[model samples]
Target: MKAVTGLGWGALILTLALAPLLAVDLILIYLLEDTPFRILSTLAMLGCFYLLSTILSLFVDALTGALRSFVHSNIPRLIDTILHGTVSGISLYVVLTLFPSIDLSTLTVMAIVFVHLFGASFWLNRENSKEDVPLELDSIDQQIIHLLRTETIVSCVERIQHDYPNLPKRDILKRVKRISQSNKVTEPFHGR
Candidate 1:
């Protein structure tokens, strides 16, 4: 359910970000032919583009996640921006190539870049700040700690996610690390 919601949001955001280009394409298609058949064709083309872009967005999301895990550290803002721009630009180019009739104008390109830059900066800042938020020892934290005592952090996170679908997995992992470290420090005699 959560994954579906996230995918839906991803599609909506992709649609909004691509709106200008899509509008231009629609107008160009209509101008090429004023008949009802042309209008229907234009709509069909737009639908195909939307579906393609959404799938591409999901691919980008998964790629980003994989890259993030491999790095094992927060990506700098500059690097993050470059990564997003390069990926999005390539995705846009691929999508445009599929429908060769659509002309890529400067204004459409600018709008897409501007939107992508804004979203990337906003997301990076929000992600970086997640670590700063204090984690209280609520029921969830307690559950995380309990699992951490007998399980690896990865398994603990998976269990917590299964039980609490809405909670952020990163936060749960952070809590597990914190609690385990604190336990090691406060109960030094147990290790010996």
Candidate 2:
């Protein structure tokens, strides 16, 4: 039942994400003349937009901090939204520049930017709200940290999975990494 609900929600989210892209494609079809390269150019523009936006988003996330941190504060969420919108908008510009035949008006560009901003904010809020991990480390977290001192993260993750089948590997890795970072800050370094 849970899996089914998750699947339904996933489908809805996917549809929402693709909505802007499809809208642009429709607009392009209407605006562009029926040239031999129309279809080919349209497909290329779509591919470039997706590829460039995705790559830019990753870099933006790294620079601004993990989008998941939105769960902790609305500030990160707001920052992420702005950055995402900028990246998407820039990607659109690059694509349009590459394919000069596919010309979009200022109004269209603004509309796409607006959609990107809203979609990014909405998506981040929804995703962050779904998972609420405790800030404080538990015994299991301590064990993971201890193992990290002597074992590889992969090994620690494998051991954790073997011992706690219900625990998520991603969450475990996150906890271990966060705890390790905090420990580094709190502990003093001794220089030889």
Candidate 3:
């Protein structure tokens, strides 16, 4: 599996966050008689759901990335889906509580929406992963890339220990600095 780029992550998050809210809004409009209170309440509920889903998505992504090495990738993905489903379930429950006039059948519909959202999110993540190719680097080159990406010498040293225990930190730092300097050449452009 490959890491999702920052733009891909943003797009996925926005889609997962907004899609269900749009469904719920349409359902609310259809089920309720036209009234100011119903419209206001539905708008409020949409706002709350959007805010919660955005925060939850970001938190889940970070948590899954941090735990990447400890567990199988699918495990975290499954856990995130379940957690998102639970959030949807909670939102439905809250709506039901606030508006007792809504029929019990609405819960079943909401449950379907929850399941659909989970599946969609999982599918989106899978598709995004397909777009990325894992970075290929030798051990020393990996350390150098890490240093350049993170701009943290200490993290580079720690990465060396974790990935190449026998390699000395000083040697890695020296080679990374040399590579960094050598890659900084500027050339004047000529007409083709």
Best by lDDT: 2
Residue-by-residue lDDT tens digits, candidate 2, 71-135: 55345567778889989899999989999987667766777677667778888788668644446
List TM-scores for all candidates, in order.
Answer: 0.44, 0.51, 0.44
Clashing residue pairs for model 1 = none
The deviation in Å at residue 1 for candidate 3 is: 44
lDDT of each: 0.65, 0.73, 0.59
lDDT of 3: 0.59
Q: What lDDT, from 0 to 1, does candidate 1 have?
A: 0.65
Ranking by TM-score: 2, 3, 1
Of candidate 1, the 10-residue stretch with the lowest lDDT total is 183-192
lDDT preference between candidates 2 and 3, better one: 2
Whole-model lDDT, candidate 2? 0.73
CA error at residue 6 for candidate 3, angstroms: 20
lDDT for 84 (candidate 1): 65
TM-score of 1: 0.44
